[model samples]
Target: MFESLGAFVDHLRAQGKLVDIDEELSPDYEVAAAVRLIDQRLGKAVLCRKVRGCGMPVVANILARRDLLRLAFASPNDPTEEYLRRIGGSLPPEVVRAAPVHEVVHDGDFDVAKLLPLLLHHEKDAARYISSGVTVSRDPQTGLRGMGIYRIQVCGPRELTISIGSPPVSDFLAKANATGKPLPVAIAIGLEPLSYFASVVPVAAGVDKFDAAGTLRGAPVPLVAARTQPVEVYAEAEIVLEGEMLPNTQREDGPVGESTGYYHAGRSWAARLTAVTHRAHPFYYALVPFAAENTLLMGVTREADLLAALRRKFPSVRRVSLTQGSVAMLAIIQAAPASKEEATAMVRAALEGSMQVKTAILVDADVDPHDLNDVQWALSTRFQADRDLLVLRDLPGSPIDPTATNRRTAKLGLDATRPADQAEAFMRIALDPAARRRVEEILARLT
Candidate 1:
């Protein structure tokens, strides 16, 4: 909702989820550091109305918490299940002619320094980065489109070194490279918060990302063809940049701090830019790349992948949770596994589907898989470390993983499910629905 982002911000302020800063905020590590701190201490979105150099106001941490996420994915229910069910639904993106993002254009004098509040995050980061750009690209061969939130470094007013690896988009970019063609891509920044979450879904190649965005919103996302390129982009997008990744173009991308609260270097892939453009008074959107949004976006992809893997072997798999604290590396599955081997197989399938996954636990159906304490408790009571814990080594984890020691890392699977022969014995809580409903009704009335 290009037109409605202002309304959403107003709503956030009314609901106490948005923080307004009218004081001087610098584009350097100052703004970035503050956003990082906001994410860590009191998770909330921030809108900086004043920055030291820029004429336009800058809004950072727009998707800082579940409150903002709920706003993005709002429906009769909540954002998580409501948005996810859409992903599994048939709603396709409906393209429109044009919108507000194209109201003004400035191409030849592409100076991000003059416009956006490009931030230098860590003390050691090489230069200021356009860290939260939603890069959109199309397969040169099949013409299929993909998009993801990728980091871009502000090398010059005319250039942004985009990271083109790490998933569905990268895989397609690789295919475009092998065929000796330039990857036609566009970066769309600053749209409705729900649109940002929709970009991060790691669906396989050939699947349209915009359609997925539409499905998640329970409607079609409107798109406009970029003024400079063939790529159709978010017409309501505040900033859109068209570019090309020439075959074999590469660079030394990062040593920046990542999601694990540590540093990673040389894992960076590279690309070249062709054009940079935005709205006349574009409010640049950036996230503290390693903060809450990063954790949530990545975890959502992991959860999707994990669910797919589990359902393949264990048809009884009821739920799969990618925990908030342990990151995507840890997964817990709720299942009615018929055998010990079947429980173990569920874990194996999870690890195989997710390249970065480090641990998987199979638990009895009675326990809520979403709770880490419940999973941990299951591990403590039902699992024998020597017998039920299976450790795997030298697996390929997420290259972005700071915790994984290269190919030397190990993944452990815990078979926390009750023994197949005694399934009924460990079926812990035995509450009748009528009794539970009566207690709920009494609590509701008293409150």
Candidate 2:
């Protein structure tokens, strides 16, 4: 696998996946418009070599494609299951004494507007935002590290308000707020895409996320200490920001766009940018904020985590997939024959793990859960509305949920799994293997 961001870019280029734009596009809308449309439409990685206001080129939509995802995995089998099995539980990262991020530092009286590309995305957006900020922090009590991708809107050259919502990391910061202590954090940008995605995993509270990265890469992630803050960072990252979440500090955070494709309500929270640090030639990653790929990442995380939770109750569960473009609410799971009771239990168990799972699907092993058409066909053929549909009300609506209505949203479950050893009606059929291969070969010649 490619070790660094540049190597990954080279890999993408070799595969003709990266689009390098040399045009002088303005950061206000020109550059952002291309990023938004390319990311939302093509779903491929793009690199803008020139920006109107910023000194650096902005790269977005890198993680938008499954080809990049496959490269990140580098495995033949499905990356989702491969990822889940590889990094379900992991250990600490390898901390280096010093590296590139520490070589350049911004101390007191530093001006961020001169260094980073804090671009304004939308017309109504309040101000510029570091759209790709990957926050790195530690749990105060448990001392466990927390890495997540969240929005940070710029309030000043050095200040931005954060929206962490009610997540585990948020809860940890909440505790820090009660004690009058500011939470130390490191924001890393332009790291490996695997590292970036690992930052967003929903690990056990206080459990490290880098372990997942290490597991995916088959090696420990090299880390370096930040000069301005008491936190460690991935040394390979092009840029790093040292900051602290302020105690009882509040500012109007949102009205900036989110992954939900809507400018939801804004809240106030205090986030202090103590110092900005980066390499001599840093490549900044700017995401088209509301892209479906981001939503898919979140949905996949919830699905994998749900599979882990359901395995304890229904070990027969073999495969699962959360549907794309759900706003992160629905899922489909494929399992071998267990009991009918076990199928129902698996659905309920998944909901408990991810409250955002508004729809859970339990399908027999023959069904390809990842393919939406096949799963929907199963629903249409085997299911009737009143009998097959299962709904749960008053469940916690996850933060990204727009129709949350105060986190009270309805959930649905489909028991599409077949009865054990009962192949009479549920048996899957297909043409003979050799005969199908011959047909495909003939079709290939003609087409």
**How close is every model to the real structure, measured as TM-score?**
0.83, 0.87
Point out the worst 10-residue segment of candidate 1 by lDDT.
75-84
- Candidate 2 Cα outliers beyond 4 Å, as residue runs: 108-110, 139-144, 166-172, 336-353, 416-447
RMSD of each: 3.9, 3.2
Q: Give each model's whole-structure lDDT.
A: 0.73, 0.75
Would you list the clashing residue pairs of candidate 1? Answer: none
User: Candidate 2 — which pairs collide?
Assistant: 249-270, 251-269
Q: For residues 343-427, what per-residue lDDT tens digits would candidate 1 score against the true structure?
A: 7777777776677678888888878887777887888878888778787777888765665785446687888888989866776
